[model samples]
Target: MEVPDLRSLRAADTPVVGGKAAGLGELTAIGLPVPPGVVLPARFLNGNDERALADLLPGLVRERGVRPPFAVRSSALCEDGEHASFAGQFHSELEVDEAGLAGAVVRCARSADAKNVQHYADALGVAPGLSGQHSVSVIVQEQVAADLSGVLFTADPLTGDPDTYVLEVVPGPGSALVGGTTEPLALRLGSDGVVVTTRPDWCDESFEARVLGLCLRLRELGRSVTEHRGSPQDIEFCTTADDTVVPVQARPITSLPALSARSFDLTFTPVCHATSDELGALARLDKVRLRLVAESCGLRVGRAWIIRAQASGSPRQEEPTALPPGLSDAPQISFVLQDPARLGGSIVRRFSAVGSRSHDLRETVQLVGASHDRFALIATEIHDAELSGVARRFGDHVVAEVGFGAFVPKGVVATSQYVCTTDGTIEHTEPVRQERAFLIEQGMPRAVTIGRTPTLTPEQCRMVCQAVEVANQYHTRPSVEFGVERDGSLFLIDFVEDGADDAGPRPEDLGIISSGRLAGRVVRVDDDRALELASLDSHFHTDRPGAAPAAVHDPVIVVAALPYLSLESFIRERDATSLGFVFRNCSYLSHLSIVLRELGVPALVDRQAYDRLRADDHVLLDTADRTVAQVPEAESTP
Candidate 1:
């Protein structure tokens, strides 16, 4: 029941006075210029005591000769958190006199139950309640009689770049700006300089200079508030007729981008770029799956490492962080393949003018077969999706569109290919700009021109080279595919190994297995012969003396008679990265096909397909088509 002065409270008083009053209190406590205010604590707001609310007027009027005209605003206890901003959702009454202060406070308290507030809260999946009751505190403050008002975001709200500060200023008080009624001057200030993105016709040279000066002065003030709050802030501020800037409110930037430790940085160097000679040195550590080889040599599978979620009886996590697999991502270590493959590449851009609009981000995600209500926002506003998997492609460059990488091979966008050097430097062809992007209408992806200008930036081009350098700077000479995010962050989508070096046979000469599921080196295991532990006839094996295989070794496709009950244990052992099988005939459950299917390993039935394959010869297998084809030796790296 403590109805205290706003200056007497701090940010920790949120549960009592709510987020708005607590923010003002924090600013006031630290000697930052804030409009004087007093808070009617949440518990007192619910007390239904008309007499106790009477102190609000005297407090508003006693603010160092401040006058009768005031602002009464709702400050819900959960108003501003990291996840939801709740901006403009509640009520605010400006220019209220002493006679109307009582009514304004009542309206402010009742705004918590308003339809817009309820709907906005429900969308973010958190109720602003304490102990089963939706709690709200009322803030009666000395309204600033200002020459100009605006909002300042300490960081770039769109891209989450901490180095940028965005200031949006209107000619008068901020109500018109926040209510979406007026066009404001939008200035983006970074360490480099100031850039005005939006300037109204009336904003001339001197007016623009004053606004820019105010923005520069607020830099340290904004930084101080952010440091004190332990996060970037979205602040409401006004410039007085005397040219002094005063902060009116502060709140944590909801939807601030929080990237994890596996952050894909542009300056990152790969684990190792194993040229052909280095690949031979790695023969002692043979793991035939290209994904495994890439990782062993310090190559990332995609732009960033992807982890899978597990189903269980434990508590659910808000984000994915474990290494359990199913169909969504890769279930086991796998290889890439392309028919008639070339040493060319393509830049797979998903979002058009990313960081420009929310719909563009939605459309970008829709192309990748991902959709959610969270992605819905205004055409020009882009918000962060705290944790996300932007784009993933499992297609071996067969078809050019798919939702997610399915059991079948497919891509997410239409793109033209470019040729690159062994070190992943773009050489012959200039990358094409995607003419159109796809948006999800109903349940299907439809081509649209809404998000265009989706070309790669120079920074994005450099990131692609870096991503590809680590992934394919090896003997494979793989055709690399990359995804450029909406914020211009680049990710290496996949690498398609044609299994051909410059001196080897063209990929098509190796024969066709319809399309491929994954690739592995051939090691024909007949029904009677026990598998050898030694590396053999292929470059993948070292023949290192005294080397013994363990429960977790490299993968090899066994070509022999149908799987029997005795071979089940050997096939199921964890010793191999992931074992595959090739039999002469096919059946669903009669042979070991059921187990192989359950384990998500490659299995096929075709006798003639083995004619072109031999021990240690690399091959791509299509389990559904029941065939396998030899792949030529991979090329050398940089």
Candidate 2:
């Protein structure tokens, strides 16, 4: 079968020509300079029929009439999506002569069904049945000996700003930029002009303006594509020896934000009707007013409840008023405080529970919060009542309502988040790419470790992809929390409501967690109870389950507030219970984290997860996929 000339194709031929060839075809049609090329459609491999391929080889060269120095690249039908770029996960054969051309084409076809490519496809939620060996097309282009080549992002990938354009230029073929070996001239193009952020000292100032103009044109090209697709594009270009700006490849920018935190049209009506900023402000104002306002917002306030007794030297006795609406339904603690004059100084304070089972969890949390300085707001006076001694009770009521009794299989799992889009696109983080260099060099390892550590396996990548696909099945721009299991299983645990802060907890940033991925139930171990559990020897009672108890059978992840117990106790208890993970509001460099890592239990010091956790909430800690999720009930039991 004769290879199809790129000039004979258009964007409509992507199914036959593949993404790269189709894009080049479109570029050539738009009067953009593109190296001449042909595409061997994905159907070439007919079940190891080598003799048929050998017969078709001579016809390809005869049709193209190009002899040597060809570029053979994999152009899978499923790649280069509006929401994903399989970047750096496939093979590209550069500078292949006639003898090597056929082999390169075969390799490119082989790479299409490679394990890594499958992982990438899985992570992006691509259909597996569509990406087999027969589904990967091969692109053969005349090698452009570029004097200069680079990549241009039409808009900032991070922060999703449309006005900002990012350009990275290197002196050789774009491969050098992709390889990450040579530092490039990094330029930021705004409303003004080019500003060189990072450049090699050898670069002449005169080259800046020329490079700027080329970059501006590329940005315009990106804009044209974006106008058509309704989203920005990432374009790759090279300047030939003749100074022709040749467009090589283009794909949609996947890293752009799908939705902002400020704009949330939620399906689940919020019980706490306050934005994070507003909540911060209310914490500083009158305690009673804050409580009332929180109640009005539908938030079940979890702070102290103050009572006004007989005022000193007051003649008339006031009947003790009935307890607040929800406070009297459950167990609470009573104390006395030197009441402020506003509530008539010196009154009784009661720490009552609400009907919500979460109240018991809150009481223990208050004690832990008081010791650790993690709790920001405190209840002082409610209405016209004065406060007294304040303390909370903790014990049986605070234990987990349900138990999780399974362990993650021993394999690497990755987490990835996605946001749905109005244009039917599901966007994720920036693609992982590297430019090529004719000659490659290996770099020294930054840090060396002793033993084999947990990492992302082939199964994990597919799992991540599965999660993204599941998330896309729901609402537009859904906040998906998903991860892979050690056994290569995929779990799309949570589809959180919008308005979750982007600045929230990140497990990888914390230094304590040594394991790359983990899964368990979130159990809050109160400060006092944590200390007690830590003090116990290996014979610690297995019968009485601690609030955040370590279990021998089920993997239990302990979440503790700051200013927690000693390292020895933690290590002992973790060993006794076969604890799977630990997270605390400790510093990344704190002794606690350092010791936990040394003990070989994966731990992290991200307080954001700690503060938001509830008793019995199942959570999965996946560092590879950069996701942490509350495992949904449907999958939690086993």
Off by over 4 Å in 2: 47-55, 65-67, 129-134, 201-209, 228-230, 259-638
- Models, CA RMSD each: 27.2, 28.0
Clashes of each: 2, 18
lDDT of 2 by residue, 540-567 (tens): 1111111221324455667765323233
lDDT agreement of model 2 with the native: 0.48
Report how far residue 493 has shifted in candidate 2, in Å.
55
> Worst ten-residue run, lDDT, model 1?
531-540
For residues 139-160, write the lDDT of model 1, one tens digit per residue: 8778888899989898898887
> Over 4 Å off in model 1, which ranges?
48-56, 59-66, 128-133, 259-638
**Residue 424 lDDT (model 2):** 21
> Top model by TM-score, which number?
1
Candidate lDDT scores, in order, read 0.50, 0.48
